[model samples]
Target: MEFLDEIKAKFPNVLESVDGSNENESVLLLKDKTKIKRVCKEVKNHFDILFMLMAVDKPPKIFELNYVFSSYKTQNILTIRVNIERDKAVIDSISSLFESADWEERETYDLFGVEFIGHKNLKRILLPEDWPGRPLRKDFEVTDEVRNWTGLDLKF
Candidate 1:
C-alpha cells in the first residue's frame, strides 16, 4: 500500500475515493479526467504494465473508465477509475506512458467513442473508420444505415 499512500499524499485533490478492501487489488477513483495523464506519469514506476483499459457505459450520463495496472514484483494490481460525462467522452491519453495503452485506448475509442488526447495514432482499431456510431454505447441504435453498412439489408 506504499504506492497508494504515495499517490494519496501527492494528489489528494484529484482522487475522489480509495477502496482498499481487497488484498492484492486497490481501486482509486479520480475526480478529474484532465489530471489522469499527470497521475499516470507520477505512478508509472510503481507498476510494471498497464494490464487493461476498459469502460462501462452507464447510460444517460456517465462512462466509468477503469485502468488496470499490474506489477510483476509485487504480484499486485491497481485500478484507477474515472467517471466522465457520456456526452463529452474525452480523456487524456496515457499511451505515452504505457505502450499497451496504445491499442487498448484505440479499441476503447473505436467501440465507445472515447477521444484520448495525446495518443499518437488515436484511430479505430477494430472497426472501419466510417462506421456510423459507437456501437458499444448503450444508446446506440441499430438502424438501416448500420444494416446497409454490414450488408444485412441484402435480400437472398
Candidate 2:
C-alpha cells in the first residue's frame, strides 16, 4: 500500500483532504488538532523526517498550521495543514515526537501567537517576552514605543 493510501485508510476521519501535484509531493489536511502528534508519529515511523513547521495567517480569523515531512527513503514530501480559529489558536505539541519542533513551535507561538498545547517550554523563541503582539498576524500594528525606539515615522 502507498503512503497516502495507508494514511487515508488509517485516518479517514481525521484527514479532511489530500492534494499534490504528484505522488512525491502530496499534502494532507488533518481536521483535528488533537491527533497531530499521533499522525506525526506515524509519519516518523515511516522514516519521514519532520523538516519544517510553520504557521500562516489567513485573514479575518483563521490560522493555518503547516507541517512538512520528508522521507529520504521514498523521496516523498508530505505537508500537513491544520486550520484553527485565530481567537482560539491552540494545537497539540509535536515537540515530543520531533525535537526540532520545540524551537519551531516556539517561533510560531512567538510570531503568530498560536499556542502549542503540552509544549514543555512554550515561550518566546525570537521576540522578547514583553513584545506587544504577534508580529506576523495580519492585524498587528506598529506600536508607538517601537517607532520611538527606532526613530522612524512610518504608519501601519
The best candidate in terms of TM-score: 1
Return the lDDT, model 2, position 74. 79
lDDT of 1 by residue, 35-93 (tens): 99988987787888999998999998999999999999998898999999998998999
**Model 2 score (lDDT):** 0.83
TM-score of 2: 0.88
Q: List lDDT for all candidates, in order.
A: 0.88, 0.83
Q: What residue runs in model 1 are displaced by over 4 Å at the alpha carbon?
A: 151-156
Best by lDDT: 1
Model 2, position 151: C-alpha lDDT score: 37
Model 1 lDDT, residue 10, Cα: 85
Per-model TM-score, in order, reads: 0.90, 0.88
Candidate 2 residue lDDT tens string, 64-84 = 988988878877888899889
